[model samples]
Target: MQRAISIDQKKIDRYGKINGDNDIIHYDDAYAKERGFRGTLLHGPHMSGFAAEMGARKYGAEWLYRGRLHTKWVGPVCPGDVFDVRIDEDGVLTASVDEQVVLVGSATLR
Candidate 1:
């Protein structure tokens, strides 16, 4: 199955603070624009939620109760970017942005 997720600037700004991230790229539109993004990119944790939610849907909400979930950020998720979130049988989940791997990880939701 495929899941399409879109992240916005407000989400990015709030997530940066909530996740203890003070990176200018996450909260400064000028910085992001200078770096080529329209605005701030969402925090890794916020994007992780998309994958986690997908896992819960696939394996059942209780499945994550005792599992270890880990994700690595390989690419940035900018505002207005739409992407796919999918999982494999081995419980590995991936987030893709236009066919490029943005994040990869696995969960112990057994």
Candidate 2:
């Protein structure tokens, strides 16, 4: 199954505040552009959380308590990007933006 997630500055700011991740790359467009990104980049963990949510939806409460998600951030995700989260029958999870694989991993529900 697949799900799409939208990332925006407001969501990024709120996640930053809750997680104490005040990195300029997550909110400072100028700073991020200076660092070679399109704009302020989405936090890796934030994307990972989205992947986890996909697992939860697929596996129900079992995933909530026993889900294991291992992910690698392969590309950058900017605000306003709508990315796809896909889970195959084998339980592999992948996230992509603009047809580029941004995050890849697997979700296991124990």
lDDT of each: 0.78, 0.89
Give the range of the ten consecutive residues with the poorest summed lDDT in model 1: 59-68
The number of the candidate with the highest lDDT is 2
Task: Compute the lDDT for candidate 1.
Answer: 0.78
Off by over 4 Å in 1: 36-39
| Candidate 1 TM-score, true structure as reference | 0.81
Candidate 2's residue-wise lDDT over 1-110, tens digit each?
99998888998899999899877789899999998998898889988998888888889889878988999999999988997989888779999998999999988876
TM-scores, all candidates, are 0.81, 0.94
Residue 43 lDDT (model 1): 80
Checking candidate 2 for backbone clashes, the offending pairs are none
